[model samples]
Target: MTGRQVIVRRARAEDIPGLVASSAGLFAEDGGTRDSSVNVDWPREHGARSFAAALDDPARLVLAVEHDGQVVGHLMGSLTGPTAKRPVTSATLVSIHVRPGHRRARAGDRLVEEFLDWARRQGAEHAEVTAYSANTDAVRFYERSGFAAMTVTLRQPL
Candidate 1:
C-alpha cells in the first residue's frame, strides 16, 4: 500500500501508457508463468493500438486504478449483444490486474463493481470471466465477486 487513496476510473486516451504497462506486467507475471505460449512482449508491441481502439468503442470498457498518482492496475471488459441463436446481452470481464503492492486494497473490487454497473446499464443480464484453473487466488477473488464456475475447459497437448 502506498498510503495514498486509490482511484479507479474509466481509462482515458492519456492513460494508454499506464494501461499498456500494467497489461504487460500481467502477461509477464501471470500468463507467462502459467501458460506455455503467452507472448509477454505483445503488450509492449501492440497494446497501444488495441487499447486506443477499446477506448473508442462503446461496447467495451477499460479501467485504470491509480495509487500515488501512478497507474498500478487496470481492467478491460466487453459487452456482447443478443445474437440470432442466443438472445441475451452478456458482459465479459476480459482482464484485470493490480500490482502486487496494490493487491488486498480493494482496487480490484472497485474495478469489478464499476464494470458490473456498466453492464447493468447496458442491459446485460449476465457477466462472465475466465481465469486459469490453477490460479486459485483469482478464482477465489472472482467467486467473492459473485461469479461461479459454470463450465470447465480442458486441453491436451499434441
Candidate 2:
C-alpha cells in the first residue's frame, strides 16, 4: 500500500474475472505471445470452476491484492505434503500478477510477502515459486524477496 494504497486479502470466487484480466496483461507485458490458447483467461475459464468447487478445501489458498478497491494483483498457492525433493510441508505459489501500472511500485513484493505469511500460517516449512527464465525482471524480484535460483526448466519441441 505504498504508491497505490493497495490492500491484500484472501480472494473470493467473485474476484476471478478481475484477477484473470490482470494476469492477461501481466503475461503480455512479460513478452508472452498474445495467444488466447496459451493465456491466463483460458485457464481461468476452467480453473475458476475448479476453484469454486474447492472453495472450502484447506489445501488451496487464493489471494487478491486490491488497490483503491480494485483488484490489481493476485497470488494462488497450494499446500502440499512432504516429498523426497522437498521433504517438508510446503506451499507453492502457482501464479502471481500485478497490473502494469502497478509494477515497480513494491506492489508485487507486498503481495508475495502476504502470500508467504499465509503459507507459514498454513504450516509450510518452505514456500516456493517459479518464473520463466526469460522473465528476468520477475526473477530479480523474487531474488530480492529472499528466493534463490533452485532449478531451471529447459524445453525442446519435437
Candidate maximizing lDDT: 1
* lDDT tens digits by residue: candidate 2, 59-141: 87777878777888877788998889877998888788888777766777877888788889988998888887877788899
Worst 10 residues of 2 by lDDT: 34-43
Give each model's whole-structure lDDT. Answer: 0.93, 0.75
Model 1 C-alpha lDDT versus the unseen true structure: 0.93
What's each prediction's TM-score?
0.96, 0.82
Candidate 1, residues 1-158, lDDT tens digits: the string is: 53347899999999999999999989988898999888889999999999999999999999999887788899999999799977999999998999888887889989999999999999999999999998999999999999999999998878
Best by TM-score: 1
Query: Residue 6 lDDT in model 2?
Result: 74
